[model samples]
Target: MSFASLGLNQTLLDAVAEQGYNAPTPIQTEAIPAILEGLDVMAGAQTGTGKTAAFALPILQFLSAQTRDSSGKISVRALILTPTRELAQQVHASVVKYGAQTDLRAALVYGGASINTQIESLKAGVDIVVATPGRLIDLMYKRAVDLSQVEYMVFDEADRMLDMGFMDEIQRILKVLPSTRQTLLFSATFDDEIFKLSKALLKTPKLIEVDARNTASIQVEQRVYAVDEDRKRELISYLIGSQNWQQVLIFTRTKLGADALAKEMCKDGLKTQAIHGDKSQGARERALEEFREGKTRVLVATDLAARGLDIEELKYVVNYELPFKAEDYIHRIGRTGRAGGTGLAISLVCEDENYLLQEVETKLETQLPQQWLPGFEPDLTREVKKAPRRNSRGAQKQRARERALGKKPTKRRR
Candidate 1:
């Protein structure tokens, strides 16, 4: 349906149209109206579902249409909390874009940046504050920002925030907000934790589910490659080079793994960068910018990037290592195949990660196609007495061929 029909005024309509989205997405259509009515809402919307605009548009309209005090500095009227700084930035950007026609101001609050700058912006006045939980808490401790005047609260990626262990912080934030505020919770999946959160925070909220819960993007082509743990790096390199893949986003389980993999790929003559929590905000942003601009062929990242890091037309996503949670698999693959574009997601599964693969399949309720790459098949006995086993097996049947070629067969130690 058109955004205008969803109760948006001409200003918001023009802003969305400028963004080239004449039609409201399913989540937006359902959410904008309810939010305008000042009702609590619990929504299930996956990545790339225009979930940001669903909440941002209505909230911006609400703030702009009202006549609040314009003389004094504006306190925060809306607080949108995201799990990570990247997602907070994503949500804030949407707010800025949609509210371009209004006089309302928004501030971004997150760690890794100067709190002094954020405090100054908050002091100047802001109608909306999009932030991460920890950084927002820090501001609260310093009394840099006031939330007592907040009338609207949104928990973007609610499931992820809980998964990242922000429930206590959320409770603390909730304690400061006005009890009469409208609450909205948006999540990609609805688990027990989210259910409890909604029950505790929402008041007779309208429940909306736009897509199947815990499902990956349907536009992605997913495949699994069975390779030896030691050969996973090799297989990924070969696949990218042999298939002429570009803009590949690779996910590793650990920060060190992401860094090492990126370094090795760079040594292999591939343009690569790594991003994780340890990297400074500037460094992380630079790496992302370079990758998006095609200056980098590959971006190796930990699970922290699975929820954020939006890249338009990203064609390839590689799971160098599977995540502990099956739900994370969905998020990692969701990085590709966004905004109605098709993409390919490949997982490199060795013997140790077979269980992780099984968990993913169980979560998806369908087994992914498993195949072995040429010359990089799973060597199951590689961890055992491999040298002697190879020699006993005539060094993989090549020793007999070597002796046939008149090459000396070296004596074995007794």
Candidate 2:
């Protein structure tokens, strides 16, 4: 259905049309109506599903209908909490963009920036506030902002916030918000913890699951390459150089790994940038801008920056390092194949990551096809060795010796 049929204001609808969104996505179609009805909503949607617009559009419409008191200043009526600074900035941008034609004013507050600017924004009075939990709490403790009048509350990326250990901060923020406000929780996956938290926050909520859990987008072509750990960087360079991929998103396990890989790729003549939590907010934004604007051929990042990355038509995603959790595989590959656009996801699997690959296959309920590149095929002459029994003292002694020699110690047989 069209966004106009969702009961959005004419101006808001015009704004959405200007943004090139004429029809609502499945998630948006279900969520906007429920949110406008003042019902708590629990939505399960992956990145690039236009989930931000799902809530942002209705929020602007709802706020535009209300009449503020005199002084042209109103108490914060909505608070949107996100897990990371990037996501907060993204959601805040959506708010500003969608609410451009309305009387509503919105502001974003997060760490790694000047609190004085945030304090000034709050003091000026805004209709909606998007913030990270840490900085939100800081403002609350200082009495710089009041949430007693907040009627709508949104927890964007609820699962990520919990993963980053923001449960206590979320609980604290909840305590201060009005008890009668409408609560909405949006996430990529629904784990047991998400359900438990939902039960506590929602009141007979409208549950919307637009896609199956653990399912990657059908627009993505998935493949795996078996290579040694030391050769992964070279393999990536070869793939990018030979294939001439214009914009590629590479995922690494750590910030350090991301930085090093970006540097190496740059040395290989592919313009590259790294983004992670350790980088300054400005630096992270600049790197993402460069990648999005086609100025950089590759963007390496950790999993934390994987979510909320809304690049359109990203050609490829290279998994340089597999995540420890199998579910993260879905999120990583999701960086490509967005918005019904065809894309590719390639994983560089080392022999040591066999177990991780198996776990991922089990989660996806399908075996990822393995392809051998020319001159990059794994050596079949090498035998896969089994770990020795730990019960034998000789085996333990051998393992100790291998560890002392800077080798991977053999796993103890179960």
- Model 2 global lDDT (CA atoms, 0 to 1): 0.86
lDDT of 1 by residue, 306-396 (tens): 4677888999999987777788888888888877789999998866456567778989889897898778877766663223352254442
Q: In order, what is each prediction's RMSD in angstroms?
A: 8.7, 4.1
Best candidate (score: TM-score): 2
List the candidate 2 regions with Cα displacement exceeding 4 Å: 383-414
Q: lDDT of all predictions, in order shown?
A: 0.86, 0.86
lDDT tens readout by residue for model 2, 205-273: 999999987678787899899986778888999989988888899998878788888999899999999
- The number of clashing residue pairs in model 2 is 0
